[model samples]
Target: MQEARYTLDDLLTLMQVLRDPQQGCPWDVAQHWDSIVPHTIEEAHEVADAIERRAFDELPGELGDLLFQIVYYAQFGREEGRFDFHDIVHVLTAKMITRHPHVFPDGHLGSRRQGVAAVDVDTSAVGQRWEARKVNERDSRAATSHLDDIPLALPALSRASKLSSRASRAGFDWPDHRGALDKIREELAELEVEIEAGHQENMNAELGDLLFAVVNLARHLEVDPEQALRGTGQRFERRFRHVEDAVRESGHPIEHTDLDTLECHWQEAKRIERGQ
Candidate 1:
């Protein structure tokens, strides 16, 4: 027989009980905002990983883990007398409706545009309106620049992408991808010079500049730098695993393997990937 399903209230109640002082789980009672941030980020990444891997069966569990992070925050807010999960829902729903005025004509939950198909909506106009609304919201929050409010806690590559995107929106961007491509070559040359000079500090700064240039090129090419890097990492791991397996079959330690042999295996991995 199937068990009864738990609802949102059940989840909220569970969080409250787990966080209750004296009777609650010790770890849950001890947790605070700062300490939970890492767990929240990890859960979010796990959810993303599940989606990217097309693990639909695991998605529900992953999504529940991510939702629990929000519930934890909401529980903290309730304990502090500031807000709760309901408030979060209200703010998110209202903001989304306001931003998508074409769909929500009256900016209310029950309101919808009549007789207009989504395909017939002016997408460019919608985008402009959305940006205008966001700018107004930012200004009301006392933001001093278009770059304001980007979270400092974001991963470096993702943050760099956001910083460059904001700059592009402010008309500081190159005219096309060619300009961004040229920038990569320029940064590469500077990095090479720094390497030759053997100044560790200069090399580090130049390396960062080179990476930022590559990220800009990625933006121009309509690629996400973080996701692209993740994909590359996956490819590297897969091919390296193949190398390890081949080495094990030959009874050779990978440490003692020469570059020529390693390169041969790497090339074979590439060939297999290309179906050659």
Candidate 2:
């Protein structure tokens, strides 16, 4: 007989066994949601990188890793008698169906372009709608009332970027990208003042404001600031490697080269990489 291929249900059942107090794997039983969090974040970034590289085949494996993290959390929940893997899937699936009204609602079928018009109204109006829906959902769940549920545990850059974007969409943003640029300049000036006054906290706050403004400008230009930063990182790595190669070809380590000379090699690297 062929060994049975594991199904999703098998995964769920395995989770239960892992959480079983009497015979469960000690390591798995000892894990908590907080302990597994870093793995989940790492898996998500790996999935993003794989997708960016167009490695479709690698996506399934990376996604499986992420799913395993989720299952691990669900197992922990089950051990605490709070919820199980099934509830996790059911809540997310239902949320997806709810958010995609055009797909889920009866007698509604059209191109995504058709939905864009409704979504492009005044930003505050859209925010109001989302907030209202969120409050209603919270009320149904546990009678919570507030629009400040955004998690504070997200990476600083990501959290700032998202908060800025949401504020922009709420119509409390710069009038245009040019306006955002001015705000960036203003923040830079304030940072200088803080520096002159030796005010570390004020300088830090101003620097953050500058970065937030830049993120806003990136959004207005339809660019992802994080992805833009990553692309520049790749470019810098390639150019720096070229400098290292040139230095090695001349029989010296890169550290031995003078700054100006190495910079020339850096430009050469850029030119060659750009096919210029």
Best by TM-score: 1
Candidates' C-alpha lDDT = 0.93, 0.79
Model 2: runs farther than 4 Å from truth?
1-4, 107-147, 196-199
Compare the candidates by lDDT and give the number of the best one: 1
What range of 10 consecutive residues in model 1 has the weakest lDDT sum? Answer: 241-250
Would you estimate the TM-scores of all the predictions?
A: 0.96, 0.81
lDDT computed for candidate 1: 0.93
Q: Give the Å error, residue 121, model 2.
A: 16
Task: List where candidate 1 sits over 4 angstroms from the true fold.
Answer: none
Scored against the true structure, residue 118 in model 2 reaches a CA lDDT of 53
Kindly list the per-residue Cα lDDT of model 1 for residues 146-179, writing each as its tens digit.
9999899898899999999889989999999999
What C-alpha lDDT does candidate 2 achieve relative to the native structure? Answer: 0.79
Alpha-carbon shift of residue 77 in model 2 (angstroms): 2.0
Query: In candidate 2, which residue pairs get closer than 3 Å at backbone N, Cα or C atoms, i.e. clash?
Result: none
